[model samples]
Target: MTATAATAATVLPIRGRLRPLGLGDVRITGGFWAERQEVNAVATLAHIEHWLEREGWIRNFDLAVRGGLAQERRGREFSDSEVYKYLEALAWEIGRNGDAGLESRFRAVVRRVAAAQEPDGYLNTKFGRSGQAPRWSDLEWGHELYCVGHLLQAAVARARTRPGADDGLLEVARRAADNVCETFGPDGIDGLCGHAGIEAALVEFARTTDDDRYLAQAALFVDRRGHGRLSDVEFGREYFQDEQPVRQATVLRGHAVRANYLAAGAVDVAVEQKDAGLLDAVRNQWQNAVTRRTYITGGQGSRHQDEAFGGDWVLPPDRAYSETCAGIGSVMVAWRLLLADGDPRYADLIERTLFNVVATSPSADGRSFFYANTLHRREVGTLPDADRPSLRAAASLRAPWFEVSCCPTNVARTLASLTAYVATSDDDGLQLHQYMPGTIEHRRADGRELRVTVTADYPTTGRSGYVSRATKLPATLMFLGRCRCGYPDGRPRARR
Candidate 1:
């Protein structure tokens, strides 16, 4: 990976106030995130793979190939997305450091997935089979589009990291994306996904492929939302964000994960199309959510019944249902906003969520994971059985796996590519957003290069310093704490 791979970041806006560096440009050399990255690479990825195989989620792809999926499908309707997310994590880890073993595992999984694709590019085990539901039959809960979205995202990761590898994952994803565009174009299905992730994934796919059709499809999805196109559920249309137009909605509502995913996609579309109105709408929603609905730990949502957010300021600490996936979604939204607007406040919220919600989900060994993160635990939690999946989503204790295990894979992908979130570059100079022991190396568009080594024992000592050379332009390093210009030799300033 090279400095030119900055376009390979998870969220590479076509144009923004800042440019995010990719895993290639930033390296976590030591300290907090470095340790997390080490554990993620050494333990978390393998653990997820083991459970995915044990739970039969990975085998679901093989069943799809053998035409036994309708009878043998194991996981939930959305289980296929988990496999894609795992592949994405592998792509990033492999890109960061060429892991031959993980590389072999990645290609193996991709082969299984490739064999399942329908002739017309449709792929999924839960629908359009001998005994399964027809494709797109249940728009409210099918998650067919949602699965394809994850597939496209995995392909994007592969394409960026491996560029034209022989694994065939990229081709599989391209076919699926083409199918989506053709099937859901403006004249096609007027309905949008019951879930909101496909929107952002489509936009990113569009960016990756340089195809505006996918972008148009993503825009269509964003516009089609808030129109009550899908049937009302027991939880109501807001659960899917279909009750109000995205551009007109003032605050994020309904399912916390769905709300933030929709907002992140909307920001992508707005930035690509230069839709200021849409951008402002999303910004306002972020502000309102932060001011009212957000927890001090940067968690979102309170209603465990629907896994949705409560009405303005209706937070209950004991009953807080800050799903870990929702926290990741909130980071997705804020990171995009930070790049688009270059606001340090967005980074502040990101740091809070990263330290509290993201880090809190995984146990120390990186094996057990928390599906739902409650701010206060009213009861002492019994140790979950390490051998079995915990059926409880709100369990007080960390579980090795969940029946619906989205967070573990989500954490895997995020941590594998965590270095991308630490730094950004611009025409003027560089900006280091999060401080950890690391090295940031970037090349400007003009061919000049900058390398900076950061040293810190952050959160423990509240002190960090950076030494930068090989650059004539001034670098702006954002510190959440106060800055002391003169400390310990008056050369490198202390940020405390």
Candidate 2:
């Protein structure tokens, strides 16, 4: 069967039910090109280059660089993680739109950075010195391994998407992964990092490299957490560790970004390992957090200090410190959870965050960015200063980028991969979780055309619906039921 007819038939099981859809069918303003432009790629690469040069994010060789890891400052030492993010961004841009100069420049920077690696396969500019610690020694704060993971993933992305792409980056990633496995195995270093990025990155690397060792290493990291194996520091030992088995943790705790990243990584492990218990835990934690602690803007981590979640209903929209990264992290968790359980509510959270908070981060020009976005506004004393300029300005569609601007590039990558979150299936049928105006082309087992044209103005109008016009044979039609309704009155009455 054709994709459209299959989709129509898939809907028949829940003809009267409502389900949410993923970004596969959702189209944001500016689309992929707009995302690239905001990140200063393709049509806007040159302009972004000029701005980055002026802002000092780029060096003499057109290599992307950042000041440091501490509170947004200038003239601090350049971080390997910062460079890795930029390389990932550049690789993504090149993958989408082939630019010889950009690709060459990216490769050159990678080579230079590779040259900085030690003979032990360790690669990081910030901590490779006589007085410094070993590569993975300082897991509590240092992001060297995390940086390597990003580089590895970026290399994989470049290799898969770009023509004539070399395996240099891939080899580097392998070496890095090997180093990590050697250093942090069960008999190796008995610790994890305060930040939980490397686990997710390692999982991606394992998938790309087809190496089970990488996957095992990722699982070990998840399993070892909360056991006091990864070290205990300023954030408290429990901050990094989930305390109980991942399945037992009831609510998201500790550093916001770290918790979410770990949760997402754990979900990845659960799905790949087919651990039903772990998946159930993830769903429980997600529902608990969203219903109680999550911001109305779909933002998490209410505290500005640790960027962690507050108590239930403790959401202070005016004083909201909803970090852009946390919003992105929530989307990642939601998307993966959606794929795991085929639940529409997960997609609902993803859509809400994407449209209102995530979309509001980048300016139209793609230069300035908002690290923190709030849902409401308040005047400070008598000065009337903007409470959350990021959200407000972004809502008004202002600047393109920001000082601590990882959020912009992060959003770019997420939007590019938005196509992956559309639909899912079990042995029974497919589920449509989101309603947007787009065509889904899927082939049915019976060799028919199952094209589904979604027609709806979601989050805007209450009466949006879908029309699945079949091309070959009449198939079953089902509605998964609305997973959520932005309107307080519940599901919008379906219009004819």
Candidate 3:
């Protein structure tokens, strides 16, 4: 037979997005932590709350509001910037619980934090106040705006997703965005954060509100990045995209989390603006960094001091301070890039990080969490004061929260948004990237419910298949094979 004819005869029809197994569908394979009833979704949230309380971080709310502080910080006590992450945690906690009181508590916190904002809509507790740190004074390490941007995003999520959730937080975010737009644009403050979070926050705000202005502001920030507008101080011009445009920067640079988050936001803008060049740049950078620079566990950023990317193939697993947040950030970038180009490789990286790096962060009980996850194990490495060794544990999971706990909630939020990354569509058909037994409801262009039933023995084995029932039209199905294509144990391949 001709090659084309032979391929056409054997190819199976694949359809629908690859949805996750959901909390309900996931049946743990081994009888270890998988068998425990406390490992469920509710239990995870409870563990998160307990850790937050134990770390004395939750009390920062009272300090921000009643204590007359300007902004939350990162220490044991209240810090302005840290408060935003705490709010993000609360938002995720509320999302997990679907609680009525949590919304009220969120609103209360928002109102108190709002009071801390100076007149001009500048809403950072640490800076932007007279007789205190000047507003927008420090862009490199300040993180004042980064914190606010996250709060804005949290507000948007709370306002839209939760039932009986008030628009108060949304209003706060709007005001904050307005302030940011007025201050940080062409005619406003000529600076950007060394930590690249606010841009993504701006894009999210725009998405939540359906306002083009927020998107425009976000684009302006992205365009002005790495052009000396944001200043180049500590790490020189190359640190925070100051050396060249994000497109020209071949390898991932600067702080690992910031670079990935910025790249993700840039992809968001590229998709919205249909900027193909920008999208291409993001994909190239992602591939180069993840494949060469990243740790075996899919963690990025080798050095601890800058929390930044190291040289290519400089992945020292033992010294791997793969920040949990960096892994989350890398996943964020990969997920968006997957949508931008329906490539299955992005999905593979996401799965790798989710199972090995991200899953290893949270303790089995879900109470404690590791700021850094390491693959290597040693007796002395487990000691309390080990200078934060990178690959020091085989699977030494920590509590759900920490003194600088940002990863647990970040993981929670990513998992909550897991539905978005499950599938993608092109002109030809839908592609299923990740396999988990679940039901996917896709509204086709012709206004039909394309119901798909996914069945598989995934992770344990590579074989998987889907059955689709479409309304009003025939659906096209496609399955991109898992990263590891061959069967385990080096046996001959088995057909599904």
Candidate 4:
């Protein structure tokens, strides 16, 4: 318990606060959850890369490297985000299992991404190419900054997990981030993105590189919303969290993923700036969203038209547009808030979304995925392709590909990085967020080392059979916040 020993201990996110157990910090030896992650590595990691290439996302990168869009961009505007997300999955999968094959594939993709970067550090295959929109020109729906955000996240993951990469992916991210800082600001474009992803990524970029410019940019974007900058969009003021600033919004409104992602970034900004008002505002909005708007399966959006949220108490199960990506966004937001103050409540929704929405998105084989998760199905129709059934939200069967293929990669990355959500450390001891059977290791702030072995059957029947072996047992932190809790056979209990 010496000072040197404490300083030598590895730290988790949000330094000196309670440390959330990282991927390496906890090992899932075996169980249901462990099976899923193993499949994510063996089945999902390679499958998604194949889908990206066959779906033309990797081709888009190649075409961008040639400085033209002669093919007119095969997929959606935000297609590049899928590539970045898949790279993130690769980073974690490599961390879990030192797959030389995947590492080689990762490096190759990084080189290709480097070749695609513009001289000025701008990236986004859909822009700056011939017969396409100019760089950052269509901020309202361009998704230029959104793509930048995912790339930054992937870069940070690579740098953290793969130390010897040195393949320039981190530098590509840094240069791109610097370009964003220069382009959008007070004296620059004077507007933030129509999407809310970049703010969180900028803050994370600052944390990873020790750069204040990224933090400032994150704050700039956080404050820039709700000032009518993106008011003229398709969904009016509410579409992209531009309806009101983060500190003033009472409930999560408009696009489900956008609202959740922006709220998450707002929490990161508030934590860094020590702005309690902003933090309180985000917490308040989270309360309202979960209680009145969210579905029983922890899904967010209720409409497909704008892929947006509906009014309070308007959550209809069958008509839900609960994008799998939104479920991932909810986990990201809740995890940050949990790290902010060591509150066990944030872990509640993370578990709900993880089990019900995210876990359900992919099938057992991981060859296909669900774009939007629906709770109920009136009729399960037959299809020519058994893997691709027609149903509400997404296909009844998990389709191998989609015109908008965001969810598949999102699910991949989330499952690949699942352990980071499992446990945490306070000065006193550890806290268990999810009860999956696993092994966890942590060094307390005081330099005391503890290793925990957990055994439990989670998300099946009641959570009564659970056991742990450690220096001290962590309080079983149940996720009971902003929503109702219930059990079948006629016992319905609401959380207080």
Candidate 5:
């Protein structure tokens, strides 16, 4: 396949119930999401880059190239993943708008990261150094594979956006993926990352490169989980998702982000391998989580101590640990399942999560961010110090930065590529999942052109509607000219 075909959308399953539209297909002309996308492109992306540099997370790659990484490396063990997520955000932003400056910055970061890669494709600054612990020695918390997962995702973004561009990010990702397959294949380590990101990422890399090996590796990782691969922690085996296999879990458990990522990856594997039972298992898990574990804001992870989900109905408004990353993870799972099953409920949850949780993370100007989104604030909370990074997760104020910052970069990437999640086209007609002021254009399987303009002030004030025009209508989609839906009980309504 050509680069254009493969890198069109974020989640492109080989065969799904609906085909997702790429960043190139939908255009957010104006609206809340449009404003957020602009802020992300202008402010949040730069704000994240400033902090990554200021915090020396990006420089960790440079330190990895130089000696004394153990002494000089700053930030948490998973800090490298933030830089990669920023790169992913940049790649999508650059793809959305061919910004020459962002492209330059993207290439520069990729170069520094590429230089740090070992001769054998091992890439990380947190492990396997002079004074640092050996690589893969701390599977439960090392986050080496987790970092690689983000790296592969960044490469997926770059490949989808720029294709054969000379950035070398795709090559870097390929080498690292190859190394992973070599080291973690069925013949190799029987371990998985403490974190669950690498599973879905490996599946995506495989799709991008049309390589079965990476897909098989992803499946192996998924299968190997829930079998006591990693040593148990205080949070127990379930915290690492080592308690049961993916196909058997009825509901999402453990760390909210990890559960969501694992479910999303499992869906990818199920769809690719045509495992109906596995797909059903994930759908069941998602249904249960949304019904019980989710917050009204569409956020998850109620337990603040371990950053995990409490038992069913354990949600407390005042103590919601609804980490922004977990919100993003839930969207990932929902979006994929929506594509796979063509379920409007999935889209509904996605709309809720994007509007409340994801959008709530970044401040208005896109400078500060909320790491944990609470439904209720008990006290007149203290504002986080703008100059100093906050160590607290449930900080009352949106901090400029955090000690283990993940949400800001995650939000950046999600918003930068938010257009991809807006709409999708199937064999018959177009489906606009998320309402926004935008234009969607697509040709159906039978070659009928469908173009629609959507206008809405949703989750806010004013009316929401879409005006669709089509060359030829499919049987299921027969609408044209001006239309207005979602009106009040007595307002003049037009079918959309």
Candidate 6:
């Protein structure tokens, strides 16, 4: 298998900050983190293929190609998001292990996803059917843009990590993005999806294609948040993060995943546009979240009622609804923040969320996962869902899957692509964030390359190490002590 490093095809929005090593370049070859990723690749990725097929996502694409609109579309409106997320995971797994079968599956899914697209670049199985919701009709609950966001993300993942697979996924993404740009934004619909995912997706799509339209679209979406443009559905306008403008918000309110995903995209927008006020607002919101909203285990979302955030410092461990997807979203936001400002604080939060919330979501063998993750368990109990009695709902335990099933695939993609968050490099040298045993390689456009091996295994052995190999440049080391940096057993405090 090729040791493919994890690098973005184009993190253009924040390229000025620090560049990441490619997928196989930084490999978690051993120790605790490595084992988790290994399980994700072998067990979780394989299991999700079965789940997607069994759940009829793959079949829905086939039906949509024939314009049949089969019963397979019976799943949630955002079922396509799950499929796209799974493909993103597959992209990184292909880079990680270079499994030929997985690569073949990746191509197959790409073809299927492309086949599901309409000529107008509109894609979503939940719409266009006889009895289904009209296309892009409801911005509040319809997830057309959200699905498109995930599709663009999957395409970006494929283009970045699997450059050779010139299948229509990338083109499909471009067409879909063109449709989005033409359909929404200031010159078009002037409407925003209640969900916050499409903003980051458009920004990433802009990075991938070097097109300003998508970037402008991303900025428009980011700016549209918190304006009460939404109809205050479910948990009020705050649930959709439309209560205030992104630049004015000092804390993340609303559904956890939507809020964090929006915050992440806002970081991208702020970094690319060099919007100081917006950037500062996002930074302040992150600080507030870490200090006041986040749990000891690095989880967010104190309420199960809406899967949304509570007031400042309103964290309740026993009733925590810190969905695994939210934890992943938190890491996504943290990583972008890490790139935006070159802050060690972002790295600490990513490490904390990774070790506690994300790591605990998957069971010991990675065969099962958790949807709702809690820090405190009042009683050791299994989920009372009639169909899944063996599945645990909260705390450290996990379930094989859920009816919603977002968390399992989210974990799959996250763990498969975990190396991207491990280290970053600028013109000077690379900065190691989490203490994982791995080999990180960086390739410069001027034909220079640097490779470093981290023997940092403080998780199990309470020791850390690093060594770098370069051709002409010498890499310097900054060793942080256990007391200062931290012991692996304890959670580090986030700076305000």
Q: How would the candidate models be sorted by lDDT, starting from the highest?
A: 1, 5, 6, 4, 3, 2
- The sequence of per-residue lDDT tens digits that candidate 6 reaches over residues 1-496 is 1112345432434455766665756778899988888888888888888878877877888888776674547567788888999998998788777899898888898888888788998888888766666777888888889889988888888777776566778898899899989988677887888788988888888877678799899999888777787786757888998888888888988899999999989988888888889889999999999899999778999988888899988988788888888999999888888788777777778877888889988888787777787777877765444234232253236666566778888888888878777777778766777778888777765768888777866677657676767845555333332245532224453322
lDDT at 336 for candidate 4? 86
Report, for every candidate in turn, its global Cα lDDT versus the true structure. Answer: 0.89, 0.59, 0.61, 0.78, 0.87, 0.78
| Number of the candidate with higher lDDT, 3 or 5 | 5
Candidate 5 Cα deviation (angstroms), residue 136: 0.4
Model 2: how far residue 451 lies from native, Å: 4.6
Model 4 stretches astray by more than 4 angstroms: 1-17, 382-396, 461-496
Model 6's lDDT to the true fold?
0.78
User: In candidate 3, what are the lDDT values of residues 1-496, reduced to their tens digit?
Assistant: 1111111110011221222222221222222223222253445555555555544345544554465444433243223444555455456445544566655655655676666555566666555443357777777777766777677767655543453345466677788889888888779887777778777777767766668687788788788787876666676766676678887877788778888878977887887778889888888888899778988788888877667788888877767778888898888888767666656678778777877777777666664567777667454434343223123222244533455556766765554444344554444445555565555555544554556666666556656566666643443333333333433233545432
Greater TM-score among 2 and 6 belongs to 6
In model 5, what lDDT does residue 388 have?
75
Ranking by TM-score: 1, 5, 6, 4, 3, 2
> What is the Å distance of residue 164 in model 5 from its true position?
1.1
Q: Top model by lDDT, which number? A: 1
Question: Residue 473 lDDT in model 6?
Answer: 54
Give candidates' CA RMSD values in order.
Answer: 2.2, 7.2, 8.2, 4.5, 3.2, 4.1
Candidate 3 global lDDT: 0.61
Flag regions of model 3 displaced more than 4 Å.
Answer: 1-40, 50-61, 64-67, 70-108, 111-119, 229-234, 383-400, 425-429, 461-463, 470-496
Cα lDDT of model 2 by residue, 156-255, tens digit? 5554455235737767777878888898888898777666777777776666556778779888988877666555566566566546667678888766
Reference-based TM-score of each model: 0.96, 0.76, 0.80, 0.90, 0.95, 0.92
- For residue 369, model 1's alpha carbon misses the true position, in angstroms, by 0.6
Model 3 lowest lDDT segment of ten:
4-13
Indicate the TM-score of model 1: 0.96
